[model samples]
Target: MANPSLKACFDRKKFVVAPGIFDMISAKVADGMGFDCLYVTGFGTVASGLGLPDAGIATYTDMISRIGRFAQMSRTPVIADADTGYGGLLNVRHTVMGYEAAGVSGIQLEDQEVPKKCGHTPGRRVIPAEEMVLKIKVAAEARRDPNFLIVARTDARTGLGLEEAIRRGRMYGEAGADIVFIESPESEAEMVAIGKAITDKPLLANNVEGGRTPILSKARLEEIGYGIAIYPAVGFLAAAAALERAYSHLKTAGDSNGLPASESYGFGRICELMGFPEVWDFERRWAQPAAKE
Candidate 1:
């Protein structure tokens, strides 16, 4: 079973912080940082893992295999991104089963057209309300564990505005989504208004860097009635942007002196993740400690 500590965090009135991680190293870092939960970000997975855009490019197995590592490393529960359920209603059923088998505690599916792009990006499309409702219904029914959360996300705010987005969100909620995420609201007013509109159930707010939505603080989101705020690409964006500058400096000046120096992860840190100490301990029953040369 997934971590119950995560459920406690969810039950609280305060907003939950789900840091997005694309790989095992990031997942370990997030767990070491003591995050309550881990998010397997579609955007981060597409960019960091595959070096591709989140235009519905990744496959179900590809994503699940990646998140399975995170679930193993982090004691925290994982909420995976199942973009548009990888297809229609039947596809949603398969997606749910696969993610659940992968040991994910929750999955967030979007109501977007096939080949769906990132929520923050332009040129996105959505499926009909009825179609998405069916997807949500199938996904909720397919889950083996009743505690496994099914979040129905709507990308209608970009095309149909907040009114239609809220309408679809409610429809999905009725279809048996454990939570609702109306993605990419434009302003603070939209965020607050969406929160107001969906008062019955927990609402999820996206906090993607350089995205369309305003970067409202978690404090503001909780006040607006949002139960969770997912910062899907914060780490990836920060790492990419910072590394680009550092690499540029190194190429141009033959030195990375201007780059901010983070503590070197070095051998010991690497060995810990690889369980080198445990391996050596298993080999040595009563061996003396190594002496300094």
Candidate 2:
């Protein structure tokens, strides 16, 4: 099946559920689960992969490289995060091209300042709307393909309020953004408010599990007019917590055999997800023949 791009998804009107992926394994699983897209989220990558928060510590190169890996490994197209475009408007142009070259179908650029903080975190600041609009313009211009989506994200829900956030969303749409992501809404009312305010524009919403906001179901999100809902922490959070528990049990028992048997995964199940049979087939086909034949 052909992978779905952000552009194609907007018109579908159904909320696109993109589970966040930090590694090739998660990418493979997301693809296997028939997810419409893969979201290479900055927060999930930093916390799950680097053991850090999404505090602008990771570089653009690092993010793109990780995104490239997922895009290569999975059939799902990636929706990548390009935080603050790594700098100014010119920097946004470069960052846009960079992520495109990395094979992302869509890229989200936030309005947070350099050394950006987490959108859900306290003390978050934002750049002027004009500055962000210029960045969005550069991003829209830099995209080589019209199918490549440029998502404008504002951290304004915390800094300015829902009104300004919706205003920014409209301004971003006017400035050439393909979709607007109003990050980190704290309640169902705010979620409905943002969606209602940006009526004509394609809207993106974050569904980070265990984060500061309430989690809404897909049907509810679609009713609220959200085009995409990214679960950036779902897979990463589950994996981290499970692994931590397994490790604790092993350390205390000195053996995994004593751990809960129901929690185990079979080798074949993992191998299939990793495409082990295909690899073995390819290996056998290409292996050099021994002495006689």
Candidate 3:
């Protein structure tokens, strides 16, 4: 079962940090590491699942399938990125229902138009403020659980400007969005301004490492009045680096001997993580003995 609603955490005015995860194993690892929440990143999903960039190529069905697995793998609340809500207001409603049924505690809806790129990527465009507001309303109404959070994201900071992004964020908040995310603020001053401009609602900061935004610690984010800090590429980048190193060693050495022992999990430990021991115990307890000769 999933953990308690993220609303409780938000209500306390405590800053929440969610590490972005792309797959079931990453979800399990993040949950095991005691993260209170997980952000199912669309960017990571596209790169890992399709080997493509976040260019709005992933379909609604693709997102739903991955999110369902994330919801099942994570023991804590899952905040999924519902890119462009996959379409207009009606599609937003359907997206909300699908994510809710998948047990996600929060769904982030962005204002980018169809074929949206990653927030940090260039050449992105956003829908008009009025249109996005309607989508937010539809998303809010579609959720069966009132505590299920609707995070309204605006990529206007890059296309229009920070002021326009703030305007869209405020408009979406007024339309009943639970959280407002101003994607890709280029400076700490911009981040502070966003926190100040959208005071009526909780703000979410995207801490995409090596991206446009500066990666701030959770404490610094709280000081800036942001409610949530999401590290969307931390695990993915780390995993890629590790894989590159491992493969390079294997190719050069013709074996894994050159790799550091501390870098890998033991065979027994890997089995334990995969629940092999539990499977064996279940078989021993429930299976009948084989017929004797």
Candidate ordering by TM-score (highest first): 3, 2, 1
- Return the top candidate by TM-score: 3
Error of 2 at 266 (Å): 2.5
lDDT of 1: 0.84
RMSD of each: 3.5, 2.3, 1.3
Model 2 residue runs over 4 Å out of place are: 1-5, 287-293
Highest lDDT: which candidate?
A: 3
* Model 1, residue pairs in steric clash: none
lDDT (0 to 1) per candidate: 0.84, 0.83, 0.88
Q: What's model 1's TM-score?
A: 0.90
To one decimal, what is the Cα RMSD in angstroms of model 3 from the true structure?
Answer: 1.3
Model 1, 197-242: lDDT tens per residue? 8887889988887789898887888898898888878878776777
> Could you tell which candidate, 2 or 3, scores higher by TM-score?
3
Write candidate 2's Cα lDDT for 241-289 as tens digits: 7889899999998988777765656678899888899999999999987
Candidate 3 local Cα displacement, residue 187, angstroms: 0.6
Candidate 3 C-alpha lDDT tens digits along 152-256: 999999879888988888899999999999999999999989887888788998988789999887888888889988998998998898889889889999998
How do these models rank on lDDT, best leading?
3, 1, 2
Report the lDDT of model 3 for residue 209: 78
